[model samples]
Target: MKIIPLGIWGGYPKANSATSSFLIEDKGFHLLLDCGSGVLSSLQNYISIDELDAVILTHFHHDHVADIGPLQYSKLIQSQLNNDVKTLPIYAPNHEKDFFQKLTFNKHTKGKVLEENKEYAIGPFVIHTIKTTHPAYCLAIKLTVEGQSVVFTADTEWFVELGSFSSMVDLLISESNLYKSFEGQIPGHMSGRQAGLLAKEAKVKKLILTHLPHFGELNQLVAEAKQNYKGEVEIAKVGKSYFLSN
Candidate 1:
């Protein structure tokens, strides 16, 4: 399994990093994690919007789901170019269904609504969702492909359940939106140290820290995570592709 990051940034914009978009490829199947505004243009650089097999939205925040509307409209319009084209199936938490409905403009319908703790299979992957501590109700995803497992924690604060939820995954892609030693409580986001500790406790093979805070020294954040985590740690940037094997 390989994860291609289209964009990786926090609440603010950076030079090349897009908001938060990830593409997981395994056994000829491709799954998109999120489609934020920062990744809208970057999507074209990686794959056609029509080529996406499915889009799993973690939450309904603008930075996390901004490009959903445009992506859907482009797919609908492009279906005319090829008669064999199919509308991509989107899976999101039940609460975010209303947002999806608004994006479809009420003309287009038919999408899979995910219930917490329910298992859904897409192609070669088995997906399970766990609730997270974000502003809006969010679902953290676990994808099992072949014998390899990958977990993605959308946007959440440091919590004990996060480690338990991420248990046994080969790769953990988590949002480290804040640097260590931030004087004030940011609320609804994780610091690099917090993410590193979770990864360590989960025993994941690799920890890819993303969603870098808008204003902070990147080097310090990376250093903070490294202090807590003994495993391989990297601050994911845009245009980087990570290859994983079972």
Candidate 2:
């Protein structure tokens, strides 16, 4: 399995960067993790939008779902060029009915509601979702392929349950949105140290810090994470790929 970071910034995009998008591929199957601002352009750097097999949204925040409209339009254009094109399947939380309804405005996209804790099979992956502590209804996703497991903590505050939820995974892609100095000032995001502590408790083999804020010094975030986590830690970079082995 391979996971590619299309964008790593949080809340909004940084110069020449985007907000929260990832591409996970196994064999020939492609799964998009999020479609945030400026993601459509970044996605084309790796694969065509129409080639995506499915998309799973973590939440309805603009920074997370901003590119859904553009992606749908791109698929619509592709369908116009080919007669047998199929709608892209998008799995998202069911609470935001109006937002989900808008995503299905055209025939290019098919929106499916994701029920908490239910397992869904999408090609080579088995996915399970759990609610996270965020302003909007957000979901943290766990994807298992063959015998390898990966957990993504989309966006959340510190919670005890998350440690067990992500326990013993091969990779934990967590949102490290704040630095230690700003901890608890924000309610729905994790600081670098907090993210590190969670990874340590979860006992993940590898930790990738993502959803970084543009204002913070990147190196400082990694340093703080290392203070709590003694394992391999990496800061997510746009267009970078991490290969997973069983």
Candidate 3:
């Protein structure tokens, strides 16, 4: 399996860029990880909207779910244009027990709810979720395809339990939205050092710091994470793909 960063910024995208989003591909199944701000415009560079298999959201934060409305509209328009009512399933954590009651517009698009910690299959992937420490309800996601696994922290602050949740994954994509200097100053987000600590505890193969901050030199995040994790550490770059190894 290979994961590509469609957009890397955290709260908002940089000039002419996009906010947090990713694409995971395996066996021709394309999974859109998050549909944040500017994602639709940036996504066209790689795949057409119709080609998307599914979208899994981490949270309802503006930076993470901004493009969802646009996505729904695109799906609506495309199905009408092709005269094909192909429905796209958008899986999100079921904050409610009865999430099937979510918006199901003409079968063009639908909502799928996931119960936290319960395993579910989405195409070629086995997925799970855990709640994150954020203002709004959020979930950190884990995807396993074949023998490899990946943990996307989504958006979270430092918590000891995360170590076991992500344990021994092939890759741990941790959010490094804050710098070490601003460690305690921020809430609901982890710093590069905290991300590294989580990676170290999880014993992941490689660490990729994502949900990047727009300010400060990004390379510093890598440096800080390396201070705690002696493994391969790198910043997530847009349009770049990271292949998982056995």
In terms of TM-score, which candidate is strongest?
Answer: 2
Alpha-carbon runs more than 4 Å astray in model 3: 96-103
- Full-model lDDT for every candidate: 0.78, 0.90, 0.87
lDDT of 2 by residue, 1-246 (tens): 999999999999988778987999999999999999988899899998778999999999999999998888888778878763687889999798999887674677888888887899988999988899999999999999998999999999999989999999999999999999999899899988988999999999999999998885888888899999999998987888898886
Give me candidate 2's TM-score against the actual structure. Answer: 0.98
Better of 1 and 3 by lDDT: 3
**TM-score head-to-head 2 vs 3, winner:** 2
Worst 10 residues of 2 by lDDT: 100-109
Give lDDT tens digits, candidate 1, residues 1-246.
Answer: 778888888664577557877888777777888878767678777777766777888888888888777876776667656653565777887685568566443333246687778799988889988888888888889988777888889898877887988997888998888877762377778988888888889989989888777776777767787887898888886677787675
Clashing pairs in 2: none
| Per-candidate count of clashing residue pairs (backbone under 3 Å) | 0, 0, 0
Give the lDDT ranking, best first: 2, 3, 1
Candidate 1: count the clashes. 0
